[model samples]
Target: MKNNILNSLKNKFEQTKTEEKQIQQYFSTFDFASNEISESDRMFLVEKEQILIKQGKVNSDSLYQICITLLEVSDRFKNNGERKFMKWYEHIGLNKDRVSELLKRAHLYINYPEKKNLISSLPTQSVKILTKKDIELKEVQKILELGYTAVMDIKNNITNLNDDEKIKMKSFKYFDVKSIQKIQKDIKKMDSKEIFNAKKEIEIYKKLLKEAEKQLEEKEKDYDNQNNLKLLEAE
Candidate 1:
C-alpha cells in the first residue's frame, strides 16, 4: 500500500509539472514590456508566478537583493518617486510580492545586460558590483536599502541627470501649496532669461494638461455608454 501511494504521488507531481509547462507555453508569446501589458498578459503573469511559487522557484529575498543591486546600476525603472512607482506597478498588473520580484528582475536586466539569461533564471539572483576600493563583493544586498526615489536616481551615460544634479533635483513633487507659493515668490529672484524659459515651460504644460483632460473626458463618456448599454440589455 505504501509503494502504491508513493507511485501515485510521483504521478501527480509529474502531471503538475506538465501542466505548468503548458501554461508557460501559452504565455511564451506575451513578451514582457512596461507599456504593452494587457489584461490577459497580466493574468498570465499572476498565474505563472503562482506556478513558480508552487514549484518552489520563487525566492523573495534573493529577488529583493537583485532589485537593490539594479538600483545601483540600471536606469530603466520608474523609481523616481512613490507616485511613479505606483503608476508603473499598476500598469504592470503584478501583485505586490510579484512586483517586488519582477522589479528586481527589471533592475538586474537593465544594469547587468550581460547576465540576462542568468538573471531571468528562477534560482539565480546573484549580484556583483565593484566597490570604490575595487574589491569584488558577493554580499552586496546587505547594504543600506534605498527608497524608490533614490533607486530611480541611478545614473548612466545617456541619463539626463548626473549624480549631483539628480540629488539636487531629488524631488519637488511633494511640495505643499505654501512651499509652491514660496517658490513663486522666489522666481522673481531669478534673472530675466530664467523667467522667460519658465513661462514657456508653463505654457507647454498648460496645453498638455488640457489635452489630458480632454482624453479623460472621452474615456468617461465611453465608460458611461458601455454601462448604459449593459443596463438596457439587463432590462
Candidate 2:
C-alpha cells in the first residue's frame, strides 16, 4: 500500500511536470520583454545621480531623472486625486466647466506641492536633491513590486491546468490537419507589432534558459563524478 501510494504520487508529479512543459511550449512561441529590472540597477542610478547632484553640476541625465521622478509622483497623485475629485464633483453636482478647472488645479497642486518652494524655484538646481531622489526610489520600488505581482498572476494562470485537460484542449484544437495548417498560416500572417516584439522576447528567454540548463547539467555531472579520492588524500 505504501509503494502504491508512492507510485501514485510520482505519477502525479510527472503529470504536473508534463503539463507545465506543454504550457511553456505554447507560450514559447510568444515573446515577452525581460520584465526583470534588478534593484541594483535602480541603486546604481541613484548613486550616480547623488554624485552629480552633490557636485552641483546638473547634467541633462540628472535633469531627466528629476523629470521622470516628478512625473511618476505627479501621476500617482493625479490618479488618486481624480478619484476623490470625481466623487466630490458628483456629490456637489458641480458644473462641468468648473469641475474641469478644479481637476487642472488639482493636478498642478499634486505635481508641484507647495512645500518644495526652493526646488520649484530652480527645477534644474540639485540642492537638497537626496530628498526627491529618495521619494523617486520608493516609487520605483513600489512599481517594481506591482510588476512582480502581475508576473506571478500570469505564471499562476499558465501553470494551473491539469495534464489531461491540457492534452485534450490541444488535441481538439488541432483535430483536422487542414484546419491546423490554416491556423498556423493565420498565426504567421498576424502582423501586430506587439506579436513581433513578443516573438523576439521569447527567443531571448529561450536562449537564456538553454544556457542555464546547460550550466546546471554540467554542475550535476561534476557533482556525480566528484574526486572523492583526491579529497581523502588531502585529509
Best by TM-score: 1
Residue 46 of model 1 has an lDDT of 70
| Model 1 lDDT tens row, 16-59 | 99977866665444455756788887887878776765454333
Pairs in steric clash, model 1: none
Native-to-model Cα distance after best TM-score fit, residue 59 in candidate 1, in Å: 55
| Count of residue pairs whose backbone atoms collide, per candidate | 0, 1
Q: Who wins the lDDT comparison?
A: 1
lDDT scores for all predictions? 0.48, 0.42
* Per-model TM-score versus the true fold: 0.24, 0.19
What overall lDDT, based on C-alpha atoms, would model 1 receive against the true structure? 0.48
Location of the lowest summed lDDT over 10 successive residues in candidate 1: 141-150
lDDT of 1 at 227: 38
How much is 82 displaced in model 2, in angstroms?
71
Cα lDDT, model 2, residue 179 = 45
